[model samples]
Target: MLAQVRSIGSRNACLAAGELPGGPWAARGGRTYRTGASGSTSEAITRARAIRSVTSVRGYQEVGRADLFIQVIPFASPEDARGGLTELRGLPRTMPQSKGLSDVGELRTVAPPTIAGTTHVEAAEQAFLLDGEHSRTLTVWCVAGQTVVVAALGGRSEAIRWPQLAEIVEAQVAALG
Candidate 1:
């Protein structure tokens, strides 16, 4: 289970495993779409999965590949978006085979391969690329109040998926509160 740090009074304390965020929220931004408590952790995971939906757009192709790929937005709060990417930088140590980070952002090695990057709202871009693998997966963690998107492309020729993911990423950011 993921550990959490908290403050009992004025002193900071580290809670044991299985501890909740504390009270209603140890961390909260604008309210999440989640309502009501889930019965179990499995249920929570299911809920999280359900909230994240996939929409197809041009540029991504799955014409022919043994392993199919999918893109996912891990979190969607402004702080979570920015902080998450910032936190991801440390993933290289925990997750080897990062292929050395790129000018875009940090990436973690996963099944079917993966690409990750960040786009300054001002600059407006999602830097991405497929690894040597035949199939590639990408996940964009955007700042809260912004859209988070990623794309899975079939092969090297599928580089076109970047532009399509970029468009949706922009729209999602626009939709954010």
Candidate 2:
């Protein structure tokens, strides 16, 4: 899986160095998510053989030095990929506990920009109180072909906005095509 995704390289990179004003996004190593002593694949996915593999690429944005992780999960078939989308949405919400700065904010649904071959798109965001600071994560996921592409941005006091993430997600899907 590492070789497969590593082969993607910069041509599929979410953000280029110096593409934005605050210099370039630094490359971070990526890892594959698997189930077992070695890795994990959820029972549901295993049952349907829906997922082939899960992998992600990360970048640290210069301005806030925030982390941007784009996870790509491809399935055996587009139908299974669609089911995987619903499964992702169903994962238990383990919201972080607040330490009195402010409670976690409500999730707001976001409308993803149109992409060709996308059968589904689901996006939402919620803010968390981190060390008395406000931090939010915006996730935009889409289903194209037999793959599900997800972009998760978080950990910085300054939030990573939608346009930036969307650009990355679009590039990723395009590269897969």
Candidate 3:
């Protein structure tokens, strides 16, 4: 999935991953990376094999003491994108363990506001308490058309509100266009 998004060409992919100017957050340490089409790393290869025509971009930022990781993946077609979206939507239900975190929470469906002129869009949001204190929120959006734009935002739960998540998704869709 990630590998596919990475191959979508650097500039647009980076924008889609939330490397926006004067946004709520800035890239952590101004550090960012982009992978080429021929990814050699084991993780890259695994992600590449999982999704068809996958390309991805990623950006990282710090919000207070919390870290935000943003990722965007674009697929070759809507059907392929829908398949990836379904797989993502099922992750919370299929996984019993939250890596090492004990306070796992349910994944809830979010009614994504219509992004006018976007081909198709779907979204989901989830929040979980880490170590029984700090909260983490994971919000994902998938837009389908000639390419499927899969965007995700992860940060300290309380630090990011639903409105902000929606804004991020809207920005990504606009960028994808």
Candidate models: Cα lDDT each:
0.30, 0.61, 0.51
Q: Output the better candidate (2/3) by lDDT.
A: 2
lDDT of 3 by residue, 23-62 (tens): 5566542222332244544442344344443344555564
TM-score of predicted model 1?
Answer: 0.31
TM-score of each: 0.31, 0.67, 0.59
Query: For all the candidates, what are their Cα RMSDs to the real structure?
Result: 16.5, 5.2, 6.7
Best by lDDT: 2
Question: Taking the tens digit of each residue's C-alpha lDDT, what string does model 2 give over 51-162?
Answer: 3344445455544545666766666567766877777776655554545546677777777666555778888887877777777878877888767777776665474677
Shift in Å, residue 73, candidate 1 = 5.8
Q: Which has the higher TM-score value, candidate number 1 or candidate number 2? A: 2
User: Cα lDDT of model 2 overall?
Assistant: 0.61
Once fitted onto the true fold, the runs of candidate 1 whose alpha carbons sit more than 4 angstroms away are 1-61, 65-77, 92-139, 144-154, 158-161, 171-177
lDDT of 2 at 43: 57
Q: What is the lDDT of residue 176 in candidate 1?
A: 26
Between candidates 1 and 3, the TM-score winner: 3
